[model samples]
Target chain A: MAQQTLEVLQSTDLKPKPDSSELAFGKYFTDHMFMMDYAADKGWQRPRIVPYQPLTMDPSAMVFHYGQTVFEGLKAYRMSDGDIRLFRPEENFKRMNHSSERLSIPPIDEDLMLDYLKELVKLEKEWIPTEPGTSLYIRPMIISTEESLNVAPSNTYTFMIILSPVGSFYKEGINPVGIFVEDEYTRAAPGGTGNAKTAGNYCAAYKAQERATANNKAQVLWLDAIEKKYIEEVGSMNVFFKIDGEIHTPVLNGSILEGITRKSVIELLEHLEMPVQERQISMDEVIAAHEAGTLQEVFGTGTAAVISPVGSLQYKDQDYVVNNGKMGETAKQLYETLIGIQTGRLKDPFGWTVMLEA
Target chain B: MAQQTLEVLQSTDLKPKPDSSELAFGKYFTDHMFMMDYAADKGWQRPRIVPYQPLTMDPSAMVFHYGQTVFEGLKAYRMSDGDIRLFRPEENFKRMNHSSERLSIPPIDEDLMLDYLKELVKLEKEWIPTEPGTSLYIRPMIISTEESLNVAPSNTYTFMIILSPVGSFYKEGINPVGIFVEDEYTRAAPGGTGNAKTAGNYCAAYKAQERATANNKAQVLWLDAIEKKYIEEVGSMNVFFKIDGEIHTPVLNGSILEGITRKSVIELLEHLEMPVQERQISMDEVIAAHEAGTLQEVFGTGTAAVISPVGSLQYKDQDYVVNNGKMGETAKQLYETLIGIQTGRLKDPFGWTVMLEA
Candidate 1:
């Protein structure tokens, strides 16, 4: 297929960018956004960069009623040397197509989409933050736009990429936080839309998240839907445990998200010659390990936090402190290494960082 | 609390109503719609009946990315005496509040909301079809409108009700549909948002529906997410099986929707002194009954098609014809009685119909 032309219509009225220190995640967006429309007859067409503005849609748009939408989150960093970088962006787009398949949405050309993203990032280079911990968060989303109330898959869709200047997830140091184990609510189950980065999966978790907040915890650790025993994820990130001297995480189950950061951490650990295992880790086993004094650490990995260290776990009305309620060695090492590579301060041995021309 | 006043802004240019014979489901909409907004501080304010038009929302609206939405389906019928009536609209509003609770949305005043709906329907009475099977389909929806990317509940929301003139679901008489028993993809699981009439629940089942469609079936019969042995729902509706002259439906498990139509059917059957069991009806039991020549009938219940008779069920590469590929006597009786009561032609002993003053 021939590559589609990229049309750019710069915003004549650009909003003043906020100070880097004042940036909050997804609060402030840049002046321009990338948009594309898809129809069953026209495929994907009318790709353009336009001013960031509100969307006008019919009241009966399928997305408003059916939730046929998917999204991806990544970041663009403004390095100390004044260059822009993206870490393993191709993985995000690839996973997006995988999610699209599950949602019955048409897939975008991965390579072409990546090229367009780089173009978009290049045009919005001035919006990228130069702060030590700040970067520009990119949200690419697709929503069904058909003006029909039918329950079937929509014939029309809208794809958009918006950029937001986000502050550091850990404004202070990487302090360990408490997690509440959720047995009443399930995040994903086998044969469900858990692996897909669709809109429904996120909001379906609000009740449990609210419970965690009420319990004075930083996040909720989700369990398998059936048994409610095996750990699936923590908050919106993949979870990990340091048992004795080795790393352990749940395997690539159908209901758990295939997080890019989770994959990178595994590869990095293997490269560093550390023992890691991907298998079902139940709460019972964790309790057993904690009793045996072998539960060393617990952490979560995702695009936003990268590595969120868990200090204590509240399960069955008991609080189990891990590693004396402190960030463990493995989490600290992984965070520093990943941040260094992402910000272009370290060598990209895995060739995961992609650079955009000024 | 004092009831909020409803403001009216009628549309000057009314749309030409489609012919009752040509009406299709959710296609042609009425001129006016009911809208209300909810904010953290204001609660639900600005209740109004406005012109039906497109919605202008920020590109970063939470509903576009997180699927924080809930909706309801009902209908307004034009009686033979030239009166407009609604069947259990109070029930719909009550259920909508229940759905909103699950999605973490603030509940609306059900009685006041129902009053606003009646006012809106009265204003658009001319759009209601007078044909035997035609009526104005009412869709009430609530969507998260907060312009943020945070994975938390939105602090702002929009609630609206739109009307569409829909034709009869059984234009050529109530023909039974073939169903494919699905063991691959599950509609929902316990601890998930299965009971809520949320947007995510519908689209998440599209993949399995597509599989059923590809197999030349009319709908997918979803099984439980865990064991994949017990029946859950048929497509988006509640399922019922008649074995040995007894009606059996899956119990109100956390993973099954509390359908109003299903409730009505059960009540109607009990009033008629028929045996009805609300318990776990596993696929194993269904198959055994089929082999024993006791699986007399199968059907689905929902708002769109009050009673969708299942002629055959394709399970594990085998087809089991129910009632010899025809609509059973009980399903036919329920459909007629329900339709007669809704159309004001039969006595509504249960007081399910709410008449709207013309």
Candidate 2:
């Protein structure tokens, strides 16, 4: 197949960018957005950067009826040197293809997609927030556009990359959050779409999140669907538990999302000579550790929240507080280091950050 | 709450309707559709019947990214006496609300929704197919319209009812279908959205359906996610088996859909003095029954097919032919009775059909 050329249509009436302080996650969009279409006969074609606008879709579009969609979340940071950098964007595209495979949607050329993304970021460089924790959130998504009610794979799709200027995820500065251990609701199972970065997987957890909120918790800690025993994920992020002196996380067991930040965290820990084990850590083990005074810290990792510390866990009518309801020493250190590397304030030892040309 | 009034807007340009032979499932649409909007503060409002057209949605609508949507399917029939009839549409609306509750979507007033449906169906009565086994398929759906990237319930929603003239589900005249037993992928787990008529639940089964088609089977039979032993559903329909002259179906566990047809079938069986059982039916027990020649017949029930006979079961590299690959007597009876009642030909003893005023 021939390489497709990027077609750019700059917005004629560019809207004023939101003030950095007023920016919330996914609230303020940039003037221009990237879009691509996929037809079964023509492959992915008509890649263009168009003005941000509403989508005109047939009411019978497959995405609205069958949930055949996949999405990736990452950010473009404005470095102190006035250069824009994206943290492991190639990884997001790669994982996106994986998610598309599971959702039965056609894949895009990852390298070409990344090139298009960089071009978009470079064009909208002014939109990238330079605040200490704020950056331009990049949402790459694919939705089935076939106007059919058939419960099958769609013949056409729409892939879009929309940029949003956002404030820091930790609006109150990385404070530890209380989690509700959900036993009544299941996010994913071993043979389901849990691992895929699909829309269904995220929305399916809304009920559990509501229950958590009702219980006065900030987020939910989901357990396995079958046994409701082993740890899976916390809210939308991959979770980590510091037992004794080592970091333990649930293995990528078919159902758990292979979060890019989770992978980077493991690699960073290994580089720093800190112990990290990826295995099935059951709730029993976590509770036992908490009782034994060995459960030092708990945190979640994802593109949205690079490092979210867990202060307490509510499970089976019992509350288990961790590290005195405060962010742990390791969480603080990792958060700072990861943020430093992402913002280009520190050296990129793993070559994880990709710089956009001026 | 005051009952909302429905506004009707006739189509100025009506499209040509397809011939009876050209009628296929959900391929063609009617001239007008019913629509309603729901806001967190205003509830469901502005119910209207407008020209069938495309929907203008924000690119970042929650349904496209988070799958916060639900849908229901039923049919309208054009009776021989020139009257229009709906088969258990009230049940569909009720179940749709149940599905909405599970997906964290606000429920629509079932009575008011049904009134709107009747108004729309009455307006498009000409679209109802009159051919034998043909009807106007009614698809009622609710989609989250909030333009947010957050992984939570949307504050706004769109509810729509689209009509499609559909021919017989069995183009080949009610022939039995071969079933592929899916052991690798799961449709729904105990705590998942399996019972909800949500978009995610349907699309998540696409991969398994593809596998079934590749194996030269007509449909897939899903087992429980936890054990992969008990039969859950067959190609989006409730499954029934006959062992030693007794009708048995999987109980309405949290993972199994509460199919209206399944319920009616059980009721009909009991009225006919046939022994019916709703309990967990394991694959091992099924295989054992087949070995003993007691597995007389197997079939599936849903709004589309009414009753679909299972000719064969492919499991563990072995094919268990049911009733010598022919439609069983009971399945034939149920199909004719259900179709007859739905089409207003047979006596409506159970009052399942709702007729629209001329």
Candidate 3:
């Protein structure tokens, strides 16, 4: 394999970085962004970190017409000792490759991409916020660039990585949120692109999300596309339930996104000696558990918010409040432990966090 | 809604027009293309026909991240009397509005938009091919343009129309083509955006299409997402079958695209006093009908091909040839009648063709 070299071109104009407390998710981008291009004739080449700016392309580009695009999200936390840290960043790129295969995009070398990400973080290290729950959110995405209206796999693509300093997901403190079970719009189905982090899956979700928001809820709880009885996911995140002193979540079904945070939560629960099992748990079972007073806690896992406790769930105009609409002990413990591990504050027992040299 | 003003910026340099014999589908565009912009504060505005060129946008545009885009396709034909005509152009714009609503894009005034399209086709009248089956392909698309990575409905959008002079779908003559039944991948679910002409639906289909192409088939015959048994569509077109003397097509299920051509085919068949039915048709039933010698013909209907006869179907590596791999009489008559109506070669019985004043 030919080694690709990075050509860096720093920005001449640099704006003052936002204070960590005021950083908003996906807003206030860094000065530089990583970019690369791929074509049928030329493989992935010209890897570079250029000034963050708009891109120019033909309006008839295939990405706009057909939308063969996939994306990944991760974060870089500023360690207490001033070293930047990444929590299992390799897993994200691995899953990104899985998404690439599903979307028919070219596979990226994980080591090379990780090195590029570390280089980007090193160059924009100052953008890594120091405050609690604050980190530099990294977005790696691939978009078809072939300017053809023909409905086929794109021969050309653009791989880009942009950074954003994010504020705390919980402004005051970790609190429980309300979820509305969605029945109108199905996010994905079996033998679909649900497992892949593709743009369409996210696009299909907005309608359900809008409905949830309109009803004063935080997010939509997606049911299985086939039966619409089984629980699949909560918004873009993976869902987990603590019922009768056992931790349960839907298995790695083809229609549910394989969330890295969800995996970590399961591992953390097992490590804490709490019984954890990945199984098909239906909404009816959840409702029955709630009625039987065995539904102890409900939470969602993702890179953005880590673990968000669900205080209540609304299904067909009926509200199922969990644990008196409060965060349970297990939810609190998992949040703190996972957050601590991610920020390099907790002891490294599983070697999940990789520390970067300052 | 306030009437939007039309702005025109004519292209200074015009390329030599391609010969009708050498035209290719979706290849070689006209000198000018229509463009429009929409924002939350200012609605859809500044409709213009500018020089065909590339568009510049931020890499963080929502369309790249969320795939919130929809499109419509139609054609304008050059008559034998040196006049230009459009078939159901208003219907295309009305369907575009349907797509826009499904995609959370602001609705476009169908009448005003139809006027702009008429103006565009009138300006590009010379580009309309005069060949037997060739016409100027019209593509109208709306894409989210908001520069945010957040997964939500875009506050800004761009709607544009581009015209393409095309070759005939059948170079020599309309003939039958083979289809591969897609049992592995599901195109769209019941509650998904299957009916909407969205980018994601097309993107999700390319894999199945590629598989069919690899197996020497012309297109993929999609099945219902849930059971994977009932017929939905055949590769971006509506599927139709002729059993004995009656015509049958899949009902307008939420997962089946409501093709305008399909609607026209039913109306034309009813006008000809042929019995037609729209209901659930399964693969097993089709195979049973074939074995029982009741399956007479299979065809697909769309704006591009008008009526395409399916000569063969491959299911589980088994090929089922229809009408001994020959075009059926019904398929032939429908194809010729539809083409004649579209190209201004036949009498206007349904008033489907709208002739533009040049």
Candidate 4:
């Protein structure tokens, strides 16, 4: 393992930061950011925490032209004991590196990167919200910095982590939202980068999501590309369905993201003695089950929201309301259990929480 | 028709730039760039030509994270009589807006955008190269600029065009180069963004291209994602084969880009009274044709290279050298005819060339 020497620099002129309650997602940034450089000869260099500033990248930077970038999102929470904690950050770290590998980016020492993250969290512990349902969101991104039009993995790269004080992900709290099933376009393919947390996958879905929003839907649901019959994902989150008294999700078909929150939901469901299965569930099946009165519930899971209960689905000018257009019992239970464990209200049997020093 | 209101900002520090012969691809840029903004309320603003400088974009810009960006590349050439001309520029403009529509980006007025491009080119006439195989490359790009994390098209967007002085596309000149037949990863898929000139499509092919270069190949020969047996593209360019006295290229499937140059090549071949067919050509059939001495020639085409002849194809540890590892007669003829028309050596039969005031 290579030792990382962190260079620290404090901001000279800091603005009067916004209050935690007034904070919006990814809007207000922290004073300092963690950064590191990668090169062919040096592998990965020492990390640094410096004052936040605009990047001086060349116009021909590969990231600007080729979209050779990947990022991860997580949060730091302030516990009742005045200590900061992170929920399964290692999982995020591992998944990020996996995404990097798919984009042909150089891998980093997860332990060293985690240590640097912890140090940043410690230094900016004040940014962590003390209010309920708020925390400091951390964005770790890697971009190609090489100044060339050549379509190749950059010889030089920058990995940086920025912190943002954020409030609730959904403006309407945990109320069920409407989603439209995307028909014309597909997000990822069987052998595509859909499974990886790359920027391209999200960007590809932006247009369809916009159309859905214009049609009065909150999110867009994606189906498999081959047949466009099987359910894939819901934009940024993995979807779950309760059918015939059982919890089920679309299988990891190399085209659906293996969301961290999705995994946690499965574990929580299994712990609660609920039957769960991951399989190729089609749209026809979902519609048939809804009409047969066995659909029970529908929801999505991601780090942004512990669980997003989906109230209705719109497809081809037709609307299907789930469970009377309200949040279901299973979704409510899952959200509360996950949020309780995250906020230290419930005991964590999986050792998924990591407490930080004040 | 939307009247174009050009806002001109005269640059103060315009340098006496270097001559075209010493130009490197995408290195030296023009003094001015054309920009326009798009919003939901205001569809697209009037275009403006301002002094080129680094844009002050928010750190959470969609282009910087989710890769919500698309770009088009074409060039302005200096004719013998000191007049500037654009080769099939309408095709490039039409295709760019098509890409925008598919990516859910707001489309620009093609006529106004063209007028703005012409005005910008007129101002930067000195940047156009007079040397052979050299010209001023124009890059028009659109990016989402909303400083939010929601997976949707930005309510605001920035459309900009920058010019770069470039030499020949190939570093060592266009000699017959070896191509690796890639059977593993794919660049795009059916019902995907492959048809759009999006950044993600190029980035996805980078790793495989790098591996091909590492193995002493100039490019990777892309196969269809399903079964991986049929020829699709050469990744960056569209592939063409001369078998049994006829020209053959892959039909534009949803998984492959419909290159402007590819269309031109097909047109040129037909104009030359040669038989051409756009159909699926399998790898086994290609090998059989090669072994039976029916494979007359093989080449790839794009705006960057015009035409790049293939020396050999490496597939599964086997090498199949085309035409004794040299450029074929058919490939040479096509290259000469295409280059002749672009450089004004041949008659403009299709009125494809648009001359600009120098």
lDDT tens digits by residue: candidate 1, B77-172 = 997678898999999999999999989999998999899999999999989888888889999999999999988999999999999999999899
lDDT of 3 by residue, A1-358 (tens): 2677899999999979987767777878899999999988888999999999888878778898888998999999996679889989999999999988878888988889998899899999988988888999999999999876777889999999999998999988887999999987999988789999988888788778889999889999999998999999999899999999888999988989999999898888888788678999899999999999999999999999998999999998999999988998988898899998888888869888988887
lDDT of 1 by residue, A1-358 (tens): 2578989999999999999889998999999999999999989998889989899989899999999999999999998678999989999999999999999999998898888889899989999999888999999999999999999999999999999999999899889989999999878889999999999999999999888898889999999999999999999999999998989999988999999999999999999999579999999999999999999999999999999999999998999999999999999999999999999999879999999887
Interface RMSD over true interface Cα atoms for each candidate? 0.7, 0.8, 1.1, 1.8
For model 2, the docking class works out as high
- TM-scores, each model vs. reference: 0.99, 0.99, 0.98, 0.93
Ranking by lDDT: 1, 2, 3, 4
lDDT of 4 by residue, B252-337 (tens): 88888888889988888888898579999999999999999999889999888889999999988899999887888888887888
**Higher-scoring candidate on DockQ, 2 or 3:** 2
lDDT of 3 by residue, B1-358 (tens): 4886799898899979999888866768889899999999988889999988888888888999899998989999997678898999888988888877777778998898888999998888889888788899999999999887777899999989999898898998877999999998989998888888988888788778879999999999999989999999999899999997789999998888889999899999999999689999999999998999999999999988888999999998999999999999999999888988888778879999998988
How do the residues B1-358 of candidate 2 rate in per-residue lDDT, one tens digit apiece? 2686678899999999899999878889999999999999998899999999999988888998899999999999997678999888889999999999999999888888888899998889888888888999999999999988877899999999999999988777878999999999989998899999998987898899999999999899999999999999999899999999999999999999999999999989988999689999999999999999999999999998999999999998899999999999999999889888988889999999998996
- Residue A152, model 3, lDDT: 82
TM-score (chain B) for model 4? 0.96
Q: Could you list the CA RMSD of all candidates, in the order they appear? A: 0.9, 0.9, 1.3, 2.7
Instruction: Judging by lDDT, tell me the better candidate of 2 and 3.
Output: 2
Q: What would the per-residue lDDT of candidate 2 be over residues A1-358, giving only the tens digit for each residue?
A: 2488789998899888888789777878888889999999999998899999999999899998899999999999997688888999999999999989888999899999999999898999988989889999999999999988888999999999999998988877778999999999999998899989998998889899999999999999999999999999999999999999999999999999999999999999999999689999999999999999999999999888899999999999999999999999989889998999999999999999999886
Q: Score the docking of each candidate (DockQ).
A: 0.90, 0.86, 0.74, 0.55
CAPRI band for model 3: medium
Show model 1 residue runs off by greater than 4 Å.
Answer: none
